[model samples]
Target: MDRLLSIEPLSAAAFAPFGEVIAAGAALQRFAINGGTTERLHALARARADDGDVVISLALAQARQFPFEISMLERHPKGSQAFIPLDQRPYIIVVASAPTHQPHAFLATQGEGINFRAGTWHHPLIALQDSSQFLIVDRDGPGNNCDEIALQPSWWLTGIDAG
Candidate 1:
């Protein structure tokens, strides 16, 4: 039988199982800096890779229409991955619990992003409506950290920003 998952609004507690909800105004140690010109939030979350070195890069992801069909889930054993949107557009996050393959989904809000835990199972970035740019933070070096599983019947994001 085929599985269809309803998309859910991204939240800290709900998403804590797989990763974190990266929201700026959501209680992450804010402090005034540089004569109050900047507010610095401390230690939002930790990003890890097996190699212990992280690199910042930009990825341009094309838009995928609604009721997105999920074909596969991939994971990085070496380190964690974080996606920060530069276009301030909404996006989809599909993840599943490791070993058991219990799936979870999320929709990123404005000024919000996510950091996938190292070795966490997740789908690649899904942009909604239009093409989007993201700040990608993940492990870099020589290592077979990436792992993937292609779904048999495949799952789908049935609902848009619902549930």
Candidate 2:
């Protein structure tokens, strides 16, 4: 199993080669805020939930506040994408491979997030010191959108140590 690393905020350009580098804060087009007044607000790509044209809800839970465990890791083989909202203060982990370099590990801060490409290697439901509830938006279709990669039972990244 690979060791977990801290979530860092690198330029979106770094992830361009693999797929589109969309920042949550950039893709969103805010519609409403405060009172009746409205404006376009761009949110994190991985933070926005969209089911065609619907906006779903996501939440978060703190560490000690709620005791929980992640019993699995899943992947998407088809051209599926995911938007996992960090409702609480938690971190994110991304496992990707560079064309000519060794595989890389990425950890994102509570404010940071990721948009995984279909078939990318990733951990399932990672919560660092929090029962981070997420607005998980992925393909809920015919074939299996959730592909579990069974590794050593201990293959887990349990905390945020991004430095």
RMSD of each: 2.2, 6.3
Candidate models: Cα lDDT each: 0.82, 0.47
Our model 1 lands, by Cα RMSD against the true structure, at 2.2
In model 1, where do residues sit more than 4 Å from their true spots?
Answer: 161-163
lDDT for each residue of candidate 2 in 80-116, tens digit (9 for 90 to 100):
3554544534454545442222333344444545566
TM-score of each: 0.91, 0.55
Model 2, position 41: C-alpha lDDT score: 49
Candidate 2 Cα errors over 4 Å, as ranges: 1-7, 17-36, 41-73, 86-88, 98-102, 150-163
The residue-by-residue lDDT of candidate 1 on 17-130, one tens digit each, is 887767775557889999999988766668887756799999888878766788888999899999989888888898988635657878887868899999889999888856
TM-score of 1: 0.91
